[model samples]
Target: MKKRLAIALMIGAGLLIKAQVGINMSAPQAILHVDGQKNTAPAVPASYYDDVVVTSLGNMGVGTKSPKTRLDMRSDDRQNAIGIGGTAQTASAAKAGALRYNSGTQDLSYSNGTVWTALAHKAPNDFVDAENPSKQSFTSGTQTIVTNWTKKTDVNGSFNAATGIFVASKTGVYIVSFTFSLASGTIANDSRYETLIQTNSASSATNKVFKCVGSYPGTNGLSNRVAGNCSGIFNLTQGDNITVNLNQALGTSKTLDADATLTSLSIFGL
Candidate 1:
C-alpha cells in the first residue's frame, strides 16, 4: 500500500510540473500566457502566429515566417500599411527608397532609388549675402563682380567667401538671384548695363541662365541710379560654381550700390 502511494505521488508531481500557466485567463494557448496573449514577457525572445513572426532582432513580418529585411511588413492596404521611425545618419548616403533623418542638416530626407531629396516642401540648402564691398566696377566687356561679401547666411556652408561663388554641395535644382543698383557716368541712348547670373560650367554668351539689362534712355542724368535684378532656376551638380557677372556696352565704369538690400545674392536648393 505504501509503494502504491509513492507511485501515485510521483505521477501527481509530474503533472503539476507540466501544467500550463495563465494570468487573467482561464485557458492559455502558449506555455505561458497573460490574458490569452503570447510572449508578453521580456525574457521571451520571439512569438509567431501561423507564418507571421517576430524575431529576436526586433524584426516583425506578416505573411512570412522568416523576415529577410529589417522589417518585412506586408499588407494589402496601400495607404495605411506601414510606419517607420526612420534611420538617422550624420550625412546622406545612397539608399533606395529609404526615409531617414539627417543629423547634420537637422532635416528629413528620403531616397528615391537614385538620389536623396529633402522631404520638406522647400529647399533645405539656402544662403543669402547682403553685406560686402559697397561698390564694384565693370569696364567694357564681361567682368566678374569681385564684391567682398563678408556677411553670409549660408545654412549649408556651400558659399565660399574667398572665391565669391556659391558652390553646390548637393545636386538639385537651384534658384539663384542677384539684385544690384547701377550708377554710370554719362547716359547714352543705346548704352546698356547687363547683370548676369552666370555659371562656370556653361558658356556665358549663349548659356547664361539669367540676365537683367539697365538701358540708359539718354534722358536720365549721370547720377541716376538703376536697379537690376536677375533670377533663374537651373539644374546643378555638386561642386558647380555660380557667380554674378556684369557687362557694359560702353567703356565706362558702373557702381554697385552699397545698400545691403539693394545689392545681394541669394540661392536656394529645390
Candidate 2:
C-alpha cells in the first residue's frame, strides 16, 4: 500500500511540473500584463512585483521594453526560471553608476553626494607721493627773507656750507635775533661794534624793524674795528624778512668788512 501511494505522488509532481507557466521563446510580446495591469511600467512607489516569473524573451531586457515583465515572489522562483537573454538595459539603470555631465565648460558638478564649483578671483591697491629737496639759499643783503626750512639748524645766522643762511618757511611767530663781530685788521683793541635788526613787510623803515647798536665811541668819535656781537627778538609776521649790516658809526679810520653776521635769528608767532 505504501509503494502504491508513492507512485501516485510521483505522478502528481510530474503533472504539476508539466502544467506550470513558462516563456514561449519562439514568439515575444512587447507588452505583457498578467491580470489587466501592465508590469513593465515603473511602479508609482519606485518598487513593486508581479505574480509569476516574467522576463524578456527577445534582445530587450526586462524593464527595457514597453510593459516589460516582473516576477512577484516571496522566494526564488526556480520552477519556471526565465533566462536573462537580452542585452538591452533600462535608461534609469544605465545611468545609475555613470556620470551625468563631465565637460571642462561645466563649472559645477557632483561627487560622492556633494555639489562643488570653481574658486573666485581678486587683486590689491597702489599709491605714490612727491620727493623733497636737500638744500636752500638766501642772499647776502639787508632783506631778512625767511628760508625754505626743510630742516632746523644749530648754527643760527652762521655761514652754512650747504645753504649759507639760517632758513625758515613755516609761517609763525619767532624771536628774531642776530650777533655781529668786528676784526682788528687795523689796530689792537681799536674798537668794537654790535647791532641787532629785525624786519617784516609791515616795517617800512628801509626794510628794517628794530635796530639796536652796542659799541663805545673811540677818541675819533667812531666805532673800533675789533670784535662785536648782538641778538634780539621783535614783534614779527609770518613771512617777515630780516637782515643786519655792520657800520663804523662811532670812530674814525674804521674798516669793517663782511666780518659781521647774524649769530642767532628766530620768530615766535602769536
Candidate 3:
C-alpha cells in the first residue's frame, strides 16, 4: 500500500511538471532537429507566430504575446535617427525637401523640378496707363502748361503750346530749346524775341533761369526761323514743376514754339 501511494504521488508530480513545461524555439518559426540523429519530421514551411522587427542585429525568438527581432547583416552601414513632434516638424521637412507651399490648401507639394513659379505680391517692371487720354496733371508757378496729347517726350524734344511756357509734367535732366518764326509779311527789324527755360516760381530762395535769343524769319518761308538749344543737368524732386517761358517784349507777337526736352531723367536710390 505504501509503495502504491508513493508511485501515485510521483505520477501526479510528473504530470504537473509536464503541464507547466514550455518549448523554446531558436527562431520565430519552430524547426526541431535532433543531434547525431536523422530528422524524424520533414521540413515544413516556416511561419512567424509573432511580429518581427528587423534591425542591425541577430535573430531573436519571442513568446506568443511578445515580439521578435530579425537581423540585417550588412557589411557596410551608416545611419543616425531621431524623432520630432508636431506640425512644425512636418513643415520643416517639406520645406527642406523643396516643397511648394499652397496657401489655399495649407499643404505642401513636392516640386516637379522644372520652371520657376511666381512669388507672392511681386511688383511689375513698367507702369502702364490702361485707360485712354491718361490725364497727367503737373503744376507750374504762375502759369500752367497743359498738353493736349503727345507721345512720350524725349530729352530736348520740342512742344507746341498756346501759352508762352511749356509746363514739365516729368522732371528730369533736359536741354531746353526754342524755335520762333514770324507770321507772313513781317520784317526782321519789326520785333525781337526771347526764349528761356526757368523755374516756375519767383522766390529768391531756389529758382534757376536759362535763356537765349535768336531772330525769327518772317512767315514768308521756313527761313529766318530762330532755333536755339540749352543743355544742363538738374536734380528735380518729384512733384517739382518746370516750364518754358517766351518773352516777345522785344518783337511783334509772333507764333512761337518752345519745349523742355528731358536729356536723361534717371532715378537712383536715395
Candidate 4:
C-alpha cells in the first residue's frame, strides 16, 4: 500500500510539470509545441500558428513571427522612422547622417558620415542709383574732383549718400558706369575733360579703373558744354569702396552740369 501511494504522488508531479510547459501559447497544446494552437495539436504548416516563431538561425520578430532580418520591425505607421537625438556636444562627435541644431550660433548643421558643415546664409546683392545732379567746379590743372551726389536710391542699402561711395556688401562682379556734362560760361582753349571711375580713393593716374578724355573747344557768350561717360566691369571684394571722380583742366570757370539725367552714376551686381 505504501509503495503504491508514493508511485501515485510522483506521477502527479510529473504530469503537473508537463502541463505547464508550452511554446507559442500561454496554455499548453502539448508538452512543447513549436506551433501551438488553442484547440488543436502541433502540426507541420507553421502559418497556422503565427503568434510567435523562432527560426533555427535565432531570428525573432514581434508582429511578424517569421522574421526576415535578425530583428525585423514591421508597422504601418512607423515606416522608415529613425531615432532623433536632439543636440550634440560637438559636430565631430556626431555619427554620419546625424542632424542637430547649434544653439550657440542658431544654425543647422549636418554630418555627411565624414565631416559636418553649417548651412550658409545668402549675401546681400544690390543696385545703387547715383545722385540726380552732381555739381562741382574745377579751378585749373589736373585735380581730383568730387561728384557731390546728395541723393541716393539703393536696392539693398549698400550706398552712402553723405560720402558718395558705394561700399560692397557682397563679393562679386559689378557693372559701374557714370555720365557727366560740363558747362562753362567762358570757354578757353586747351581745356581737357576727364571722367574717372575710382576705387577706394580720389581720382588719380594710379587709382582710376576707367578714364575717358576729350578736349572741349571754348565758347564765347554761349554756354560751352562737353559730355563724357565712362563704364567698366569690376570684380569687387566686400568692404571695397567705389566712386566716380572728375578731372578737369578748365582754365578758370568750368562747372559740372546740374541736369539730373546728364550727370549720374549707376551700379549693379551680377
Candidate 5:
C-alpha cells in the first residue's frame, strides 16, 4: 500500500512540473501564477488584490500580468523600492549598472563599474541680489555694503545680509560684483570714489582685497551723486567671508537709495 501511494505521488509531482502551475487560479497566464486573493474574473487584478506571476520568458511581475521588463512592479502604495542591503562596497567591487547601499556612509548609491557614487546630488552656490528695501546710510570712508540687502536670492544660504558677510560654502573660483549708489548726494571729485571687494576676516593676517576707483577729473561735483561699480575674481576657500566696500570722502553723510537698477550685488562660481 505504501509503494502504491508513492507511485501516485510521483505521478502528481511529474504532472505539476511539466504543466503550467497555478495557485488559487483556474487558468494560468504564465509558467507560474499565484493569486493570493483568488481574483480570477478580471483579466488584470485590481491594486487591492495581491498577485504574482512568472512569465513564459521567465520575467517576474508583482501586482501586474503584462510585465514589460525583466522585473515589473506596480501598486497603489506608489513605492517600488528595491534595496541591495549588505556590506560597504569597494570602488570596483561590482560590475557596471550595479547598485548598493554604502553601510559606511549610510548612503544609497550606484556603481559605474569604476566607483560607487551617492545618488543624492547638490549644486554649487550661485546667487544674485538687489534692492536695499531698508535704505541704509554711511559716512565718508570705506564701508561694508554687503549687509542689509533686502531681496536676496539666497537659495543656498551662502550669505548673511544682516551681518553683511558672505561665507563661501565651497572652494572654487568665484566672480563677485557689486554696485554702490548714492541718493543724489554731494561727492566732491577728490579721487576717493572707489569700490572694494575684500576677502577673509579683518583680523586675518592673509587678507585679500580688489579695489576699483572711479576717475572723476572734472572740477564740478558729480551732480552731487556718485556711483561705484566693481567686480573681482577670487579663489575662495570654504568659510571665507566676502565684504563689498565703498569709499567716499564726503564731508556730509549720505543715505543709500533703495534702487535695484542703481545698486546690486551678484556672485557665482566658475
Candidate 6:
C-alpha cells in the first residue's frame, strides 16, 4: 500500500504541473477524472457511463463528463433514486433548502429554513355531470339507496357510474359534493323530500356525510321542480366508498331526477 501510494504521488506530481490528473486514461478531460470502464476510444462517453469527474470550476459529474450543476448525475435508461431516512428533528429557517423524509406525513418535505413543506404530488380529482338527465323511481314511505348512475367523468377510474360509488384511491382530505334535481310535477305541495350522501365509514343508519331536505313550496301555481345540493369535507382512508340516496313523502312514489343545469357530483383531494 505504501509503495502504491508513493508511486501514485509521483505520478500525481508529474500531472500536477498541468493541474489535471486522470485515472485509467492517458488524457484528462477535467481537473480530476476517473474512468471506471477504461473504454476511452469513443472520444465523448455516452452520458459519462462508468465515469466520474471534477471540473475546474469544482463541479462534480457522475456518469457524465459535462456537469452543469454542482453535482450532476445521469444514468441513461437506468432507474435512479435517492433513499432518505425519516427523521424526528424539526426543520428551521436556518435549514432552508434542506430536504428530508417526513415519517409523520409519509411525504418528502422541503425546508424553507423556517418551516417544512410537504412536497406532495398533485391530488386526485374526479367529476360527473348529467346532461338533459333522466329520472329514477323509488317507492314512497321508504328510504332508498340511489344507484344506476350512467353519466360519469372519472379520470382516475375511481368511480363506478353504474353503482354510483366513488372509491378513494388514497388516504387524504377530500372535498365531496353532489346535486340532484327532482323532476317537475312529480312532487306534491304537501310532500317532503330528502337527499343523502353516505360513506363506507358510516355504516350505521343514522350516520351520513350530508343530508338535504325540503318541503313543497306551495300549492299549484308555483314550479314543483325541486333540487337539493350537498357538500362536505372529509378525511377518508384509501379504498373508502361514497354513495348517494334519496327519499320522498306524501306521493304515490318518488322519482329521483335531474335537469341539465342542476345535477353533478365532484370529489377532489385538498
Return the top candidate by TM-score: 5
Regarding lDDT, does 1 or 5 come out ahead? 5
Which residue pairs of candidate 3 clash?
Answer: 155-262, 156-261, 165-244, 166-244, 191-251, 192-250, 192-251, 217-224
Q: Tens digit of lDDT per residue, candidate 1, span 112-230?
A: 76666878654466565545555766666665764677655888787776567787776668888887766536655556778788776532333444777877655555555567778
Lowest lDDT sum, 10 consecutive residues, model 3, at: 123-132
Alpha-carbon runs more than 4 Å astray in model 2: 1-168, 185-194, 202-208, 218-225, 250-270
Off by over 4 Å in 3: 1-149, 152-185, 188-191, 201-206, 215-226, 256-270
lDDT of 6 by residue, 130-231 (tens): 322446777776777666666646666877766678877666777877777766664456677777777785233344457778776566434466677778
Query: For each candidate, what TM-score against the reference?
Result: 0.50, 0.29, 0.29, 0.52, 0.54, 0.51
lDDT of 4 by residue, 76-117 (tens): 223434454457545557776678755434456688766777
Q: After superposing candidate 6, which stretches have Cα over 4 Å from the reference?
A: 1-75, 78-134, 150-155, 186-189, 202-209, 217-223, 256-261
Better of 2 and 3 by lDDT: 2
Give the per-residue lDDT of model 3 (tens digit) for 1-270.
999999999999987644421133333222221111221122431222222222223342321121243522121121212222223234344454344544322233442344323334422111111111313222211232223323343232323322323333333443443332322333344344455556553223366766665554433342344333443444443233345444553333333232323211211111
What ranking emerges by TM-score with the best candidate at the front?
Answer: 5, 4, 6, 1, 3, 2
Clashes of each: 0, 26, 8, 0, 1, 5
Candidate 3 lDDT at 148 equals 36
Worst 10 residues of 2 by lDDT: 123-132
- Estimate candidate 6's alpha-carbon lDDT, on a 0 to 1 scale: 0.70
Q: After the best TM-score superposition of candidate 5, give how far the Cα of residue 34 lies from its true spot, in angstroms.
A: 24
- The count of residue-pair clashes in candidate 2 stands at 26
Off by over 4 Å in 4: 1-124, 201-208, 217-223
Task: Supply candidate 5's per-residue lDDT for 20.
Answer: 84
> Could you say which candidate leads in lDDT?
5
At residue 47, give the lDDT of candidate 4.
37
